[model samples]
Target: MTFWALLILTALLIAAFLGYAMFRGRKNREPAAAYDLRVYREQLAGVDRDLARGVVSEADAERVRTEISRRILAADAQMQAQTDQDGPPLWANVVAISVVAAVLVGGGFWMYRQMGAAGLPDQPLELRKEMAEALRADRPSQAQVEADLPAAPQPQLDESYAALLEQLRETVSARPDDLQGHILLAQHEANAGNFRAAYAAQQRVIELSGDAAPADAYSHLAEMMILSANGYVSPEAEEALKQALQRDPRHGPANYYLGQMMVQVGRPDIGYRIWIDALRVAPPGAPWVEAIYAQLDDLAFRAGVFNPPNIPAPSGPSREDIDAAAALTPEERQEMIQGMVNQLSDRLATEGGPVEDWAQLIAALGVLGEGQRAIDIMKEAVDIFAGDTEALELLDAAAFQAGIAQ
Candidate 1:
């Protein structure tokens, strides 16, 4: 109503201005004959005055007076003829002003209505951000967006698994305090895609373990929720993640999931750091390392990470260096250490060695203050061992001692 009122007011103001201009024009548009008559009268009086002042000869003044008299007669005849006819009615101006006002006001609103969303409240910035994040997550991982893996396939329940699962559920219910039984039931429930059941059983696992409960229970519960929703990170899943991190800040799955969550929630820098840490500590051949390797660099680029330090690969000190270091002179030790470092690095680069050798190189680099080189070695080792848990642990210890991150 207010919008309409403003438009109406604007239209009226414009119409009133136009109408005044039109009326003034009409008033000023006097017959041309009247103007000519006034000019002739002024000229006739001027002729008399000029003659008296001796500015003009009497014969010349007389000739001017005769010509001026002819013009005056013609003007008088024109004015008499004009007065006999009528001019346009006053209503014609009012009609024109009304049409102009209506057209301008109605056209303006019509065009606006055609082009704009009428009466929709604006979305808040936070809500807009959430929407954008959701859209981004739905897109491909590394290819375009954050959700890297294809939606995990929903687990199908086979007849044998289903029968066993039902029997396990009955046993768990009967022996509520049996932690192992509850754990087994929870695992089976998750396998069968019964997420809420899995969630309940995992909760029992946490309850049974009490203060001794590992962070993995909470993290696993979160994973169940996410899988249930086809990778949607809901409030319940987030709460579970919080519990996991609270119990163990560096829990492998917890860190990986939380880091991915950070990426999902538009904190890619935090996400990148989290995933990188997880990748460093994760056992060789872990799934999270692959996901991180495949996706994190792309995420870092998007986050605009400044000065992103050139962290080196993982390598460590060899046993030979350890055995010889105490006996050799400082200069001899330095040369021997350099020789071993060069050999290890060349072998790792050209013909990748065992996990222990990679760890040795990484640790050696760390001791030499080649932190960047150690980090780079670790990055390469993740792929070489990809999922070897034992090798990954060795590299992790070597990286830890060499002060890899520092």
Candidate 2:
């Protein structure tokens, strides 16, 4: 109210001052013709004085007086003409003042509506933090989110595999306290595209392990929960991610999901920081590296980061290798590829490499028509990257190319 009152009052005052100046200027002005008439009359009086003092000849004085009289007549005629043509009417001034006042006040209000925070209250740092906390606390639970989601399409299964999966499920149900049974059930359920069941089984496994459960167990649980919810990080999944981070602060899967949860909860600043730190220390083919790279620009923008660090591309087969392969005959190329694959396999077995090496080996084996070998390597890679969703996805793509079950 005070802001509005001050703005209106200032505008009115300026308009009134301008209108007064216009009227006062006209009133104070002496007409040009009137001034000219007075000067000419003074010259005529000087000519008369000159004649009386005998300072000039009578003819010279008479000629001066006639010229002065003629100038006086012309000046008087101009003054009368000016008086007949008066200044503008008073109503015209009033209308102009009203327009100026309206424009000043109305234009100011329009500009404020476009650019000012007319109604919003100021938000301090503490208030924003409190709002974020409230948002986090109000997120939906896993079950609630899942309930609202559309039913997932069921995968088609061979009769024998279906029977085996059913038998395993029955066995796990019978032996409720068996940790290994629960773990196997979780793995089989997830493989069969039954994520809800998979998470439930994983939860049981964590319960059986109690304090002995590793970060991977909690991370796996979160992964299954998120998948079941179609990529939404529910409150339960966030709790699992928290537990995983509590166990191993550098756990890749946990950190990735934690960042995602922070973004969902309207804390992109924290999410950007978490993802940046994770990417810095992450291996070339760490599961979350690609995901982080994809979202880095948007995350930086939301976090108000104008200049972000460059994200290096993931490592892959060298250009030299491709050129060498291109120069070889078909038989020679096959031999060279096989030799390279064998060397990679040997090196990975002797000293475990990043997940990229394992994926590359699987793909190479598939290209060489060694489907069984590719399948074997994929199984091993899956075990190594159990809780990592992105790594598993890479391995799955390799397996699909190898004509193996995902």
Candidate 3:
């Protein structure tokens, strides 16, 4: 009420000031012709005084008086002609002032209504952090969120593939202890958008592997859970992520999901930092890398970073190296390739390259029949790109060629 009263008083005072200025201007305004007429009349009176004091002859006084009277008549005529043209009419001036006042007051109110938070009080940083914490603490559980979600759309599958999938499912159900069968079932179920079944199969895979289950198994389970819940990270998924990180602390999927969970829980600062770290090591074309790149700016803004630093693209072999290798003889080419691979290895050890370079090196080592060396590099690459589905696929292909992956 007090604010409203003050606003109204301020507006009225402004309008009154403008009105007074206009009225005073009109009242004080004297036409140029009218001022000239007044000056001419004063000069005529001076001439009469001069004649009475004998300071001028009669003829001179009469001539001066005639000339002054002629000037006064012309000035009077010009003033009469300018009377209506001097300024806008009183009513028009009033309307103009009223419109300006109305726009000043009413437009300001309209603009405020559109952009201002009328009822909300200003929140300090500490208070905002406290509120965010409270919101995080009171957020809905996984089950609750899943219950509210609509059914997922089923993916279209060819009849042949569907029949094969059904057979695989039946075989896995009957065998129960077949680790390979469960892995296949999990992969195919996830491909078919049957996340619930996918996660169940993945859980069985983990159970069968027991303490030997790799970080990927747990991460895959968490991924399925998240997909089933439409991207919501449940306590169940978080536990899986924790298990994955325990086995391989740099697991990509686990870190990505962890960052997502942080953002969902009103901790964008933590989320942004986690994502930035992940992106630094992520291979080019990795699914998580692309996803993070797409949303990084928005995430940074929410994290209160107005200008986030750019993430450099991963470097690979130069065209000159490729052209030089291509020009070599067969035996020389092998030697050149080995030299290039050695250089790449040394460079990666000193300053890491993109996942593509890592993949290429692994493939090149396998081609050179360096099985053990390839296997060792594959292990290190796996740890670096853990949980990143696409990057893992590339590394797995290179490992397979090297006879290191089954």
Instruction: Compose the digit string of candidate 1's lDDT tens values, residues 305-367.
Output: 756655443333345856768889989988887887998799779987778678778878877
lDDT of 2: 0.82
Clashes within 3 Å, all models in order: 27, 0, 1
Score candidate 2 by TM-score against the native: 0.54
Provide the global lDDT of candidate 3 against the true structure. 0.82
**lDDT for each residue of candidate 2 in 259-286, tens digit (9 for 90 to 100):** 9888888889999999888877776656
Which consecutive 10 residues in model 2 have the weakest lDDT in total? 397-406
Q: How close is candidate 3 to the true structure, as a TM-score?
A: 0.56
In candidate 1, position 172 carries an lDDT of 82
For each of the candidates, the C-alpha root-mean-square deviation to the true structure, in angstroms, is 19.0, 13.0, 11.5
Using all chains and alpha carbons, the TM-scores for the candidates as numbered come to 0.40, 0.54, 0.56
Tens-place lDDT digits, model 3, residues 323-356:
8778889999888778978998999888987777
- Reference-based lDDT, each prediction: 0.74, 0.82, 0.82
